[model samples]
Target: MTLELRCGDVVTGCEGVVSGNTEEEVLTAAAAHAAEAHDLTTIDPATERALVAAIHPV
Candidate 1:
């Protein structure tokens, strides 16, 4: 399964591949991606929480 990631109103997971066998790992990977590739230093806390919550279960 693929996890759809939305930044604000922009969807970023459509053309991308998500890694991890579980939701938690997937979101963790995504956070690493955001920090590494996107340089998102000010990413919203709520958004991060939601991402972790939504994607952390497989």
Candidate 2:
């Protein structure tokens, strides 16, 4: 199963969606997206928790 995460779930107004074979992959992609598109250079504990919670099997 693939793991997917909707960027909108964590960042309001973002419609990006990222998926991967593993949670780590998706998180890495999401981090890149965050940095490139959202200007988020760091994932704090709360944001990291939210990102993990938002990820689901697709």
Candidate 3:
């Protein structure tokens, strides 16, 4: 999967095999990586929201 960063760079990946294809799982995992590895606490709220929404798809 391709995920666009706040800086407009697209990162194509996932660290490990996706156990379950769920939106919350994907977002939480990605967000955790952003915080832990990149030291990015605050990301674009709009983008984040969009990503989460896309994953969840009400």
Best by lDDT: 2
TM-score, predicted candidate 1 vs. hidden true structure:
0.47
lDDT of 1 by residue, 5-50 (tens): 4332233543443457666667777677667667765558787776
Q: Candidate 3, 37: how far from true, in Å? A: 1.7
Backbone clash count for every predicted candidate, in the order shown: 3, 0, 0
In the range 1-58, model 2's lDDT, one tens digit per residue, is 9999999998999999999999999999999999999899999989999999999998
Encode model 3's per-residue lDDT on 1-58: one tens digit a residue: 4332232232345333221256566666657666776676765887577555444222
lDDT of 3: 0.49
lDDT (0-100) at residue 41 of candidate 3? 74
List runs of model 2 lying over 4 Å from the truth.
none
TM-score of candidate 2 relative to the true fold: 0.95
Record all residue pairs in model 1 with backbone atoms less than 3 Å apart, i.e. clashing.
23-55, 23-56, 24-56
lDDT minimum window of 10 residues, candidate 3: 2-11
After best superposition, candidate 3 residue 56: deviation in angstroms? 11
